[model samples]
Target: MDKKKISILNLAWILILTASLSFSGCRTDMQEASKTEEIFGTIVSVKAYGENAEEAVFAALEKAKELEKIFSLTISDSEINYVNQNAFKDAVKVSDEMFYLVCRADYFSRLSGGAFDYTIERLIDLWGIGNDWARVPKISEIEPLVGLHDYKNIVIDSQNHEIKFKTDTAMLNFGAIAKGYIADEMKSEILKHGVKSALLNLGGNVLAIGKKPDGSLWKIGIANPFNPSSNIAFVEVADCSVVTSGNYEKYFEEDGVRYHHILNPETGFPSKSGLAGTTVISPVSADCDALSTATFILGVEKSVKLIESLDGVEAIFISENGDITYTSGISKYHFKELN
Candidate 1:
C-alpha cells in the first residue's frame, strides 16, 4: 500500500479500538460489584452498601463484636473493666485496645476541665447508674470511694502499649466516650476491607463514612431527647460523625426531681442545667461523644463558647422546655421539627 493509505488505515483502527474500550469500561462499573451486608445487636450495628457489601458487613460485625468486648464495663473479663476494678490497689497492665481508650479518656478529661470523668467508676458502681442502673449512693458512701478516683496517677506506657493505675482503688469507665471510640474503630475496619460506603450506629451514635453509590450524602436523624420514636433533626453528612447525649435516655424520676445520667463530677450529682439534650458534630466520633456529654453539663453560654474555641467542633443544645440552640458553624445543618 502507499504511505498515505497506510497512515489512514492505522488512524481508522485506532478510533475503532478507542470506541470499543470505552464501551467495555461502561459495562463493568462500580455498580457491578456486590453490595455490602448489615448486622444489628444491642451495643453495636452496621449497615453497608455497594459491591461486596455482604462480606463487608460480616467483617464489620466481627470488628464491632471485638470493640464491644473492649468497651464493655460490664464484661468483667474485659481489659477496660479490669483496669477500672483493680486500679485502686496495684498497677494493672492493659491491652492495646484498652490503652487507646484510656488515652482518649485522658484527653477528654483535660478537654472537659474534669467535669467529665471515667475514673469515677467507683461512684458509678456505688450509684449503679449505668448498665446495672445504680440507685443513688449515700453521700457518705460515695465520698470515701471517691479517693479511689484518680486519673492523674494512672500511667500509660505508650512505647510498650501497656497501662497501669498508680493506685489499686482507682477505676476507669469508658461509658461517656466508648461508643464513639468503637464507631471510629468500626469505620476503620470497614475502610480497610475496601468498603467505600457504610453507616455505623452504636446505640444511637451515628457515623457516615462515605457517600452513597448515587452520589448523595447520608441523612442521619438526631433523636429528640423527649421523643425516642422519631428524630428532631436530620443532618446530611459524609465522612463525619454526629453523637447525641441526652438527659432522658436512661433515668428514673423521683418525686418532682429528674435524676438522669451524665452526672456532675464535682457534686456527684446529675447536672442541673435546663438543657435536656446535646449533640456534637466533628471529624472523629470519640471527640463528638465527649463534647456532646460535656456540653450538656456545661449548659448554654459555656457550651456555645467551648464549641467555638475548638478547631472543628460544633454543638447544639435543646432546653428542657423545647427551645433549640446551636453554634453558628452548624446552624445550617440543624433543623427544628418541634411543631
Candidate 2:
C-alpha cells in the first residue's frame, strides 16, 4: 500500500474512536442512589440521580429528621410541643421554620374555610385516631369538642417568631401537611447539592424533582380507595408533588362502621362528604398536602371549584361510588385507569 493511503486510513480510525467516546459521555445513563428510613411516623424514601446522588439522598434524609423535630406535636421538647403546652398562658417563641409553617397552616385553614385545620389536636385526641388506643368516642364526649378546633384562636407573630393560643384547649397538629413540608425542604437540599433528578416519597405524598434520568416524566400511581393495596390510576408528572388524603388509610371499624383518621374539625369525627379519597398535584408539596385534605372534606363539586380558581394546581377526587373526577389542568397529562 502507498504511504498516503496508510496515513489517511489511520486518521479516519482515530476520528471514529474519539466520536464514540464523546457520544458515550453525553449519554443519559447515570448512577442512582436510593435510601429509605422511617421518619415522621412513616417511611420516607429518597432517590437521587447524578454524581452526588448518594450524598444528596443522605442529606435529604437528615433534613427530614430535622424538620420532624420541629413539627412533631408529640415530641416532648419539640417546638410544637412547647407552643401547645404554653397555650393560653403566654406567647411562646418558636423557630423561624416553625413560625413559617404555622403561618402557612393558618393560611390553608382560612382558604378551606375551616376544612383543613391545624388546631384540631383536641378533637384528634378525643377520637384517639392514629393512636394505639384509637376508638370511637361517644356523641356526648365529642359534643363539647365542637367549635374548639377553631384555627382563628391561634395567633402567629412573624416579627417575633412567636405563637399563641386564645384557649389552652387549642392544640396544633401538622399531620396533614408536615410530610409535604419535609419533602419540599428535602428537594431544596437535593438541588443545592447539584442533584437534578430525584424522587421524595414521604409515605403516600410523592414529589418528583426534575425529570427522570432519561428526561421522561415520572408516573405516580393513585391508590385505590376501595382496595387499599391496589392503584386505581396513574398520574404522569415532573417537577411537581402528588399527595392524597383518604379515609381508608388509618381507621378502626366498629359496629359495622369504618372510622378514618381524617376527622372534620367541625364535627370532630371522620369526614363523610361522599369522597373516599382526594389527590392534589402542585409544584409545592405542602400546598398539595393541605389541599388534599380540604378537597376530601369539601367533596367533588366544591373541590373542583377551589382547584380551578388556583393556578398551577390540579386534583383527582374519588367518590365513594368509585367515580373519579379530575381538574382541567390534569388533562394535559396521561391518566391510565387500572380498574
lDDT of each: 0.76, 0.90
lDDT of 2 by residue, 76-129 (tens): 888788888886699888887888788899999999999999988878888887
Query: How does each model score on TM-score?
Result: 0.82, 0.90
Q: Could you tell me the TM-score of candidate 1? A: 0.82
* Model 2 ranges with Cα > 4 A deviation: 1-29
For 122-211, candidate 1 gives per-residue lDDT tens digits of: 676676654455576678876665433367767878887766777655677778888788778878888887878888787778888898
lDDT of 2: 0.90
Residue pair clashes in candidate 2: none
What shift in Å separates residue 55 of candidate 2 from its native position after superposition? Answer: 0.4
Best by TM-score: 2
